[model samples]
Target chain A: MAATTEFELVSPGRLLLSEPVEMVVVPGTDGDFGALPQHAPMLSTVRPGVINIYKGGRVARRLFVAGGFAEVTQERCTVLADEAIDLAEITPAEVQQRLQAADDQVKEARNPEEKAAADRARGLAQALAEAASAAAHAHA
Target chain B: MASLKDLRARISSVKSTRKITSAMKMVAASRLRRAQEAAEAARPYAQRMERMLSNLAASVAGQAGAPPLLAGTGADKVHLLVVMTANRGLCGGFNSSIVRAARHRVLELRAQGKTVKLLCVGRKGRDVLKREFADDIIGTFEEQGSKGITYTEADRVAQDILRRFEAGEFDTCTLVYNRFRSAISQIVTLQQVVPFLPSPAGNDNQGAHGGHEAEAHALYEYEPSEEAILADLLPKCVGIQVYRGLLENYASEQGARMTAMDNATRNAGEMIKKLTLTYNRTRQAQITKELIEIISGAEAL
Candidate 1:
């Protein structure tokens, strides 16, 4: 529909994805929101969660994005994410490993600051793991 | 008088120095490319931030409910000057130029009877400011192995400044740096961090291919009220600003260093050429003198 509204997603080190996906979902800090062609201009913080993009008529091109920002202008929705991963490339095992490591970090934290940081890592890792699994199940 | 051998040695030394300077110039040039790319990459973020900030500023000023970052501390008694310079020397006047600008501002502010505290980011800037305002500098921030200046680094610095601001250490803040214009030119810049006021005429100076009304009075909706959002945004804004400054400084440093080294290499080459000519002349004169002396002695005998 409407040639899959053109949108560009960029991250540091390199330009990750640039395609006219049908609908791109963003995990804003407030909540997860999806955008199509001709969306309203909005700026919001992004939470650490899965950014499920529906390329090819709302049924393809899924991705998992870490926390950062999602700014939507007239025709372009830019995701300034800290980290983004193509669900196709993200193995569930990797997330589980990170989750385990984060769990250990939180458990062994000696100070309040370290504990808080580790807690954040743990929360982020758990969310990532869940998102990755969900993507795998939905695709299967 | 120096002998021909000494001239030859001096020529060789100058030639070696030229090689070193030329190598340094190439290194600086390559580094400059990456630094400039980073600076370019950071521009969009800076623009968006400034846009959001200006919009928020308007909202804050209108309701008299703006955060401390936008509304300011309502006091102009104390000032903080955060000066950023390069770490190493041989960058020509890049470091000195920024220090000079900061010194001028410090003098002007001091004359107005304002209490000021200085914060130096780079080693060169710190060394220069410490000479006069040694006791005033509360912090010197330049760690080599920190994996470049990150958002966290900026946050920490901002936290220190804000902590001091809250504690009444300083009521005002200013940052001095060099803005990279081109490979050969960098303009010394001074920006006010606190009492954030977006230039009213900023839109008037926009590029020919842009909008005005949208830019002049754009509005921002707060998911959790303006104040709360501002509370979170202020510190992040500080971090972003510092990060931008660091990036800009990185590019400017490499640019200045490259130009400086290029000039040095050229000067060294000139000196070597003159030395070599003098060495050849001295050797030729020595040979002629020996030949004439031998002829005279033979004639006398």
Candidate 2:
């Protein structure tokens, strides 16, 4: 049996998942990093992307996180996501609609602060769209 | 004495009032359970966030380049009071108690020669505080989390506050809200959120395991330096604090409403009982008077 690290995925609304996993890859602000058992403690900001959870030597599940933070310790890896969605559950149409709304927001933004927020939203939407397409391809 | 018809009307009115109050009580009870569950579910994230923040804060404390959100503006002249209350009015003294506490703080700050500004989160607080502090009110947010309190709603408020802070609007920020204790009791709490006061060591949930956690924290590495992460986390901390306050306020509102409706229902039941007794007594007296009249008429015959 492979050594597993406890993985916890939490959102502001609820605790989404808590269990032992062989490996987990998080999309950090700098880059994607995988945490395995006995990993050194590290803290980083999560980017808007997909997090892949590995179990039994294969990818078991994928979750899309908008943005938040992640903390990795030796025994556990916890990701506090601002928003999370199952990659399998999101449809292409929904992703497209979100991207369109984000684009509109970006165009209508008046000030730098508004523009920055809109840009962040646009980035998240774009990421979601990419993740959705990738998931569809993988499934097909 | 009232007529039998009036007594009957009064009894029926009381009966209807009882029914309405009982219905409200049931509704509030169900809502309270849901609100409680929401609050409970959000605890772990909040706790972990706070724990990690405090750990990072401890490492960065007393540094020259600490973020203002954690280091503060180095002054306490101006204060921002974020009063959180329910939008509706039927929740007993829940809103008033929070408002009263805020008002008291305002007066105290005034006495201390400190400038106070009001940022009300709910409609009821604004309505109550407007009479005296109309000029002091910077903003009022109504219909927030009308369906249920969500993080996005809280983030919006936090962003507004953060913007104001960036513009040098206030030096300190305090949140006044009702902390849910139980279904019948809600304690008015005044929590200072700004300047990021870490929770006391003794109050940590990881009391027994603190040594182990602290050892791990000492050896932990930061991705973009502690200062950068702290800068990012502080604003999020404000959002999380607001989220926590909103959630607690919501649960407290439901609990308070449940208790208040329960009391109203009981009072109405008592009123109905008294009205029924009065109606019966009045009917019997009228029957006796009619009987006496009939007996007198028969004797005359």
Candidate 3:
């Protein structure tokens, strides 16, 4: 039997998932990182990407977070996401619409701060679109 | 002293009132669960925000010329009170308690020769505060009988307050709202929001109330400049705190309504029982009088 690590995912709306998993991959602001049992304590700001939970060396669940903060301890990894959703529920059409809207926002921005925010939004939307397409490819 | 018809009418009225109160109690009880869940679900985010702020605040605590929102204007002459209460009135003393606390704070500030400005979130508080502090009220926000509270509302309120604060309208800001303790109890809490104070001990909220010792000791390296992060996080912090307040107030309102309606139902039942007894006694007396009248008429014949 493989050692398991406790993983907890929380959004502002609710605690989405909490369970013991074989491993978890986090999309940190710096880069992607993997956590398993007895991982060192660390804290990182999460970027907008998909968080994969693994069991028996296979992916068990995939959740997309807009952005948030992640805290990893020796025994547990907790992610506090701004907004979260199941990858299975994301439709390609919705992602495309979000990407278009974000791109429009970028063009409409008048100030540097506004442009920065809009750019971040556009980047996330693109990432989401890519993730959706990748999932479709896997299904096909 | 009332007539038989009146007694009978009173009994029926009391019975109907009991039914209504019981129905309200059931509704409140069901609503309380969702409200409580919303509040609890918000706890992790709120606590995380608080912890992150505390970390940043500790770093910038004594730095000269800190952000106005954090260090304040260093003037205590003007105070703004963000008073929150429920829109509806049947929730026992929930609204009254919040108003009373705000009233007390306003009076205290006045005693100290300070100017107090009121920003009421719900109609109940505005209604009560307007009586004595009509000129002090700066703005009012009402829920419009919404079935559920939302983060969008809180964000709108936060933006308004931020604009006001940036305009230098007030030197300090305090949030007054009911903290839901349980289905039967709510504690009216006065928390200083605008010169952000990290609550020294215990979770300011119930769901994520404490055990943050690890984060407190761990030093963090900021990816971006601390100032940039604070500038972005501070405004959002205000919104998060306000959202938390709204959730707490909603839960408290439902909890209070449930308890109040339960009591009202019980009282109505008691009144119905008393009215029914009087009604029965009156009917028996009227029957006895008729019997006596019949016996007397027979004797006379």
Candidate 4:
């Protein structure tokens, strides 16, 4: 078996990444899962969390994806995210600001559906902010 | 014949008209560049969605418990026509061609003893369709003030369609729009949006993987049931399709306008040339007539 699997990340507007990697950790809706070379074909809906790509037995890149889907074949893993951003690009201040906005949205929501959506937004923002904080602490 | 002053005034008017058309052509050309980029950018997402759906659909085809969006409602007595055209006119035949195609579809449905509902997406389309199918016109949308088409707009339209479908308003839905080919050509297209008609063969990924249908069918396994995944993806697919159509329509409108304005500018230039010739000839005639009379007077004296 090849030591690497073809991994691709696609958003609505553009294709962000397509390459071969040693391992990829996807934030599946059920839970996080790792895919390596020659994995079984499976499809899972993604959640809003960080995806870690490994190469040479170390973490090479990290990306945060807003909910989408992932399709895995034995040789390929394709992630179709609604939105994606490099973890290095987001600042803690921006994450805090987004979390505050999501909180405001939840409070101002008038209907149950609106409130649910705002709550989901808040949860995602909170998770993202926590991830950022954890990464910052690890560096510090 | 008209007076010299009138000829000169007509020439000036034609010259101004030519200027306006030339300016419009430039504007459309610039807008077409942006619209074309937007259309091209949207294609990858739409195509990928189609691939994902095809993968899911290939498994569910001929199954008894398929989603309504794929398996259809099992009836085609009522049809909804979502006609898309530019809100503004002056683009030679862009709007007319779409409306004409829509009208033909409506006529055919009527002939087949089917009920047809018209959901017009732009003012020009509504204006043309309501003249004949006022009662059949169900909804109308105008995007005049919006700077550009957005995914949110497409989602809203798709949501409305889904609501109507759930209400049992229509059994099938089709979209009519002019597919932008180039600045000089657009082809009117009629596509089935609701209860998607899938062409299993000739997909990009299938070719890329070099796998036949049977092998693809055997390879993949769904995490949640295929029905659950399809239920989520189908609405999203509808939104993607609508978004693509709007983008294509925007590009087509700009292309048509550019071509139309180019033709108008040229025609206006020709008219100005003809008018200038008449103006010059009339002025020469008046001068010669006056000179002849003066000469005759001197001769008589």
lDDT of 4 by residue, A3-69 (tens): 9999989876677898999999999877898999888887778878889999989878888888788
Per-residue alpha-carbon lDDT of candidate 1 for residues A89-124, written as tens digits (9 for 90 to 100): 878788888999999999999999889989988988
lDDT of 1 by residue, B134-232 (tens): 988989887633334455666667777777777778777887888787778998877777767543222333363155336435444444355655776
The regions of model 4 sitting more than 4 angstroms off are A100-104, A111-113, A134-140, B199-215
Q: Give the alpha carbon lDDT tens digit for every residue of B1-301 in model 2.
A: 9998888888888888888888988988998998888877887787778777877777777889788899899999999999999998888999999999999999999999999999999999999999999999999888665468878888888998999999999999998888777899988888887888854311445564455554444556777677777888889988988888888889999999999999999999888888888888888999999999999999999
**In candidate 2, which residue pairs clash?**
none
**Shift of residue B295 alpha carbon in model 4, Å:** 1.4
Chain B TM-scores across candidates: 0.93, 0.94, 0.95, 0.94
Chain A TM-score, structure 3: 0.88
> What is each candidate's DockQ, to 2 decimals?
0.28, 0.66, 0.35, 0.55
lDDT of 2 at B296: 100
Model 2 misplaced stretches (Cα beyond 4 Å): A100-116, B199-212
Candidate 1 lDDT at A69 equals: 59
Which structure among the candidates has the greatest DockQ?
A: 2
TM-score of 2: 0.92
Candidate 4 lands at a TM-score of: 0.91
lDDT of 2 by residue, A28-131 (tens): 98899999999998889888999999999998999999988898888889999999999988888898999999999999999998899999999999999999
Ranking by lDDT: 2, 3, 4, 1
RMSD of each: 3.4, 2.5, 4.1, 2.7
Compare candidates 2 and 4 on lDDT and give the better one: 2
lDDT for B238 in candidate 3 is 84
Worst 10 residues of 1 chain B by lDDT: B200-209
For model 2 chain B, where is the 10-residue window of minimal lDDT? B199-208
Predicted complex 3: CAPRI docking category: acceptable
Clashes of each: 1, 0, 0, 0
- Candidate 3 matches the true fold with a TM-score of 0.85
